[model samples]
Target: MHIIKYLRSLQIRPNFVKKISLIQARHLQTDVFETTKVKYKYPPVYDPYGPRPPPSEKVTQLADQIMALTAEERAQIGSALREVLKHPKLEKISTEGLDLSGPAAGDAAQAEEKKEEKTAFDVKLEKFDAAAKIKVIKEVRALTNLGLKEAKDLVEKAPAILKQGVTKEEAAVIIEKIKAAGGTAAME
Candidate 1:
């Protein structure tokens, strides 16, 4: 009989009132504490339980000394450090691998191989003195083996090749002969 009366008393106290009390407790727990002080310090990443490495005393002293330097001194030191980092020690590079190898090696060699072997040179008549134009024309005509009209046209053109593809020695000889003929010719 006493247990039945206690159960009846609990039912009358109400379920809604219990729910409100639980919500109020949760709200108080999540409430922001505006009066609490903020800190900037961070915890070290190293193991706190193990032995710590000795602090760098020299580094700290050096840092303090650096801090004591004037702005100009610091700037100079900074520029020096920058130069050291940015520019490495100069060393001689192989000149052979640079520009001197010419068209006889590597990519240039492949290109040369693809090209027909240079047996004869193409003589480019660049310019000739007006006084020696007729002489230059006759020289071009003799070198080219073209007909009279064709030779005349080629000479009138002013810029014409006297030969096709030749060796270096032959090309040099041709250029020298053309120079001797009072015409500016290049062996290509």
Candidate 2:
């Protein structure tokens, strides 16, 4: 508003006051009488079919709420959860589908440290010659520790993960071995 007055004192030709008033009036009208806009039918939009439905407003709101939490808030929430779970009555609710006696509470830090030092891998067979199927199957068996029949079946299914959660070194060795046996393998 002060800028508008300054412009007026500078004798700017265009009337800023009128433009500002017009914009304000339009905004007010749209805000107050916008129910008609909402009531108007929208054209049908065809999206490619998928298994999962679109996220609801509540899910979006929940996601926003979670994302907006500070680290301190998250820590506080975690402590609150721990306190709640300590209750004997709440143990059943919290431990549902989880092995309550599996690990000690003292191992939580060790588990977190292990999570930070992630060690996992995947072996994907991209392509392989039909003639080398037998050799590829043998390598898959050795790498995956699968039965002969299962390994053969896995090798036949190209572009599939051969193994997962191995060390990266083991994954590389497996990929190299498969490639040497005339099969195209990828470490993922």
Candidate 3:
């Protein structure tokens, strides 16, 4: 028919085509247009400059200095640096003109001092012999149902009760108390 031919020949705008395709696709689950597959080719790379310098000037200077140094001199300098690193003294800088002392400074100093104080358990752990410490760790693990590492950590952290003088039975009681407190303990 002439009307049908005229309608087919008429150019439908892209927006109208898109709207109709979207509605048709949603209802029929069919895409209106077939996608075209495209393969891309990379553009050729260009090098503007020639090869760079062999070594940077700073690196070359460092290499030269190293080459110039005698082995003995290097060793002496290394030892001196190690000594300085091991024990560094803080030089007191006078802040008389500056008001640096405040609540934050006092709080920081207090925190540091508290960190330095040794706990009772820490002192006891320090006194434990290697064997006693091992036993304590094992016992703590058994009593608390904790892993080997955790038990060992506990024993190592509290060595006073893990000392050679302390009996296995006494250690068991301690482990029992820890278990009762909802913690793991080993007392074998």
Candidate 4:
């Protein structure tokens, strides 16, 4: 009837239009119509919800403070932050070869070893008579400019040189220190 005419005006399909109109008519009631009435009103354009949590009060304050700083101040603050974040662990080093013990014991042992070596050399030199030894020492001192102790050392070594039949020139060369030191020898 009127529903078909309205459906035709709207250009709806005939079968669907007839079914929808019949359903609407069956469900329609005066009280139900009153209860389902919707008064149209504009929804709010701007939400009243508070700001997001990421840009919280503390973060906003910090950002504002950072933005307000001069270049030098900002650099100083950045350097300070880097220093705070850069904590390094200290390593414990083992000093096995460092030998923290005092040198007294080592010095004593070295001194004793030197004394033993000197005693051995003295025993070997005992084979030569005092006059031969003195004569050898004077010759060595005349040529080498060596002190008494060094001259004695040369004398102690003379037996070996004599065994090899070292020439006067060779002996003179060996005792060059005595000549430099202004010593004289009757033999030379």
Candidate 5:
């Protein structure tokens, strides 16, 4: 049984009544306590990506005027628009019909494939012989158009990149020059 029931059954006297009332008050507070979920509210906002409203009367009239144009006139307008918007993505917009589907997903895939084919190379300098350090410095200076001190510092830092974004033929020629100068180099 509850402690309050037990206390009441004991019938202790007026002296314990105050302590009994305090305990009952605490018990009553715990019993009356309830859990409730709190919901948060925010001000209304306009979402641009949501469904668009209908066109105005002026826009409808413009559309009707454009649609009433001759095929030749429409072709001329289409060519003029294509000239104005000279982008590969915009090329897919058809002037023959109202093609609202926009560019296909394959365009991004094709661009990724083209990017994967490496066309540029970086020339990296490996370690060089101590005796031919001057010649290596001169070679680096000639290749990078750097000052004498800058070139020497670069040569000191072995396994460093000398030049970037060079074509395959140019990279081969650079490697040959470095080899002749007694310094090892490779294309990255």
Candidate 6:
């Protein structure tokens, strides 16, 4: 090959020339043999349980005592504990002119709004009188977009949820209709 003659003229040793020719051949071929190294940024893991000591016996004993209390008593204790756990420095710091409602407060307000908005309700038909079964079926059929056979089957399956994710007003209207039909219904 012309490459060998060129390498010989340059006085590159035979073995080095062979290596050079092989590398050239590799470059001439498809780029399948070439690879690129990539550096990646991996996020640090948060392991709260790692490198933590076990709770002391006294703490465990107190936990057991708290567990033994009634649910209402435990709730009261929990509220008291939360109050106790509040940073004491917060009480010492006087904010007479500073605005308390900052971005963090806005986030808290949004969370409260999310909790207050109960937009969805599930309407459940608890029971129906044998005499009012037909009326209940009709009411259910009207409330739901189900056919007569499906509505009848739904009515027969007492204590079943008629509809889910309905608005509060719609659920109330459905409940009222079912009640008027002599079927006990509730919204959950």
Model 1, global lDDT: 0.73
**Residue-level lDDT tens digits of model 6 in 137-184:** 998998898999999999998999999999999998988889899999
lDDT of 2: 0.80
Question: For model 2, where is the 10-residue window of minimal lDDT?
Answer: 87-96
Of models 2 and 6, which has the larger lDDT? 6
Cα RMSD for candidates in order: 28.0, 24.3, 20.8, 41.0, 17.7, 20.6
Order of models, best TM-score first:
5, 6, 2, 1, 3, 4
Regions of model 2 farther than 4 Å from truth: 1-118
Candidate 2, 117-152: lDDT as tens digits: 557978899999989888888888887899999988
lDDT of 5 by residue, 1-188 (tens): 37666767788675586677776787879656777879977448867688689999999998999999998998788668767888443446456755456557877776566565668999999889999999999999999999999999999989899999999899999999999999999999
Tell me the tens digit of each residue's lDDT in model 4 across 88-176. 64468999867487668659877566553221111111134554556656655554577989767756654333112345555445445
**Residues 1-188 of candidate 1: C-alpha lDDT, one tens digit per residue:** 35445656677565655665666666787455447778877667656678767769998898999999999999888668868789664577777735465465468767765776667567777777878777777777777777778876876786877777767787777778778878888877
Q: What are the lDDT figures for the candidates, one per model?
A: 0.73, 0.80, 0.57, 0.57, 0.86, 0.87
| Residue pairs whose backbone atoms clash in candidate 2 | none
Clashes of 5: 0
Off by over 4 Å in 1: 1-120
The top-ranked prediction according to TM-score is 5
| Candidate 4 wrongly placed segments (more than 4 Å) | 1-128, 157-188
Residue 162, candidate 5: Cα error in Å is 0.5
Name the lDDT value of residue 9 in candidate 2: 81
**Count of clashes, each model:** 5, 0, 16, 9, 0, 0
